[model samples]
Target: MKYVDEFRDRDKAAILVREIGALAACIGRQIHIMEVCGGHTHSIFRYGVEGMLPSRIELVHGPGCPVCVLPIGRVDACLGIAEQPGVIFTTFGDAMRVPGSRKSLMQAKAEGADIRMVYSPLDALAIARANPEREVVFFGLGFETTMPSTALTILQADREDIANFSVFCNHITIVPTIRAILESPDLELDGFLGPGHVSMVIGTAPYEFIARFHRKPMVIAGFEPLDILQSIWMVLKQIKDGRAEIENQYARVVPEAGNAAALRAVAQVYELREFFEWRGLGSIEHSGVQLRAEYARFDAERKFAIPNISIADPAACQCGEVLKGLIKPWQCRLFGSACTPETPLGALMVSSEGACAAYHQYGGKVQRAETA
Candidate 1:
């Protein structure tokens, strides 16, 4: 409780709030700062961080939720893998709720597909080891934070000579995605709250371009209330001083150099794809990772005959606009009325880390205020 209690203190939070307000007054214009991680977005909504800030400051939610950004077509591909006879499909709990063109993985499970909810790839490996005869496929997806474990799991499978195990790798990189956002003409971000977990794995060095070339300050932020508040203050301070630099506010957890062993493991197993599709953002160059040629034996896409089709999102769902910070979650026409956590019309409504889900769950006051 030491770090938790210390970070949540009202006195410290108020001091940071006062400092941020004082800095905002000097700038005397609207400031848009994007938080590039879904966890930070969740914290902002849960702690009512937006209400505490000056009205001039708008916290734009970027496409950081891996589950939220997973395209309908890819989910369909995952279902294609899941529906195959003798195949056991394993995925994270949030992924089960993501709607495909036809049905969700959860719906598939209900209809007798061997779909499983696993905490890690190792669990899927364990299932593969247990079954021996049936094919076990782990649905791998996310930014660099979760890649090392999946890579190491593949290494473990190789060591044990597990013939029935493979990974449906949808692993993506964060740098190119951020670069894409920065290049978009519609968004005019003043700074960024960089992803904490991904930065821990890949380090703060990769983000230098955000500050150096883009001229936008970025503070690698943590998920706690105080951590977010302080990070906001850091970004504001940088803007006040006309300094654009990458600073790590989550230094206790993330290092400037990153975890070398984790990077090594990730490099050992995966290589960048030429271009990969995202739900709303579309195809980004070098944005996704696939199992290297050497690890093709453990690659599910290679092992299975998949119908890698590209399906469009629903007509009413404005997830693409929301992801680009062009619109807020509540502004989406299908929000709350047609799309709820129980029945998600869009990927954003399915995951708790998603902007729509966080807003739906905790933005009651914000919704009423905005709608009024």
Candidate 2:
């Protein structure tokens, strides 16, 4: 608990596993728990936490990977902006590989588009400042965790009067996505392992709806192996006690009230869109944010002629089903063959945090063959 190694302690993990098993046995039915964060999905596979769980508990992967959840139309739109003459398109490296309708940003770069990967939005702003003559657009994406930084960076651009810089804001919200999943007709989730990173920004307050309305318990969890196992035990405890509540196991990093300054910056720079499309989850009302009209000068959508068209995935891709937790990554026929990380055909395989990418890297080979 004190250090990284402490959170990965095998002994402590074993104890929590046993406790989880004991509690899981009391439920007398299958316990389908969803880890509503892509980071948690990657950690579960990387640390082999899924194998450590009891047979009764199933940890379903959710649409928590912000990069993986962006719909194809959005990528196509980014591609259009990137290909424009004299425009410098900057985005996180993982996003370069997300398949656009015609080609990914990586492919576009190879074909002479000035697509550069930067660590943060500020880096894009710096590129804009350094090259006053060229248009610099940062392809901003992610949940609440990455929004504040982008917002602050945009504010800086405004203060500095960087007219050449703009943001292609594809930032989405978490609460609406979670609510959409819960509202799905066939969703079978028993409880949830909430995202730790997003919780640090938005806090545990928003998740009270899950417990209060849906009557499902959710524990905001950290990414370490022990943190995951302990959270699993915490969720199992609620099930055995017939309780529904939102608990924060990541309280050491995530304050219940959230980051006030970050929230303020985001509020000042952006406003909720009427609706936004997700790769697998489709359109969820107010699930994404856009630049406020006051910041319209720095909004890429308003600045550039983007082809904002909704696109369906490849005919063979089952990423939508996998994202909905209706199918495992390996269950998709294209998993390791046509859809390997090197030549990804869907959003899930484009990012490290995505469930399909995690499965292909850590496990699911034998199952993949069965489906293949």
Question: Candidate 1 lDDT, tens digit per residue, 87-122?
Answer: 999999989989888889999999999999999999
Candidate 2 deviant stretches above 4 angstroms: 366-372
What's the lDDT for candidate 2?
A: 0.90
What TM-score would every model get versus the actual structure?
A: 0.97, 0.96
Q: Could you tell me the TM-score of candidate 2?
A: 0.96
Question: What are the RMSDs of all candidates, in order?
Answer: 1.3, 1.7
List, residue by residue over 27-46, the lDDT tens digit for candidate 2: 88988899989889988998
Which segments of candidate 1 are over 4 A away from where they belong?
Answer: none
Q: Whose lDDT is greatest here?
A: 1
Distance from true position, residue 183, model 2, in Å? Answer: 0.6
lDDT of each: 0.91, 0.90
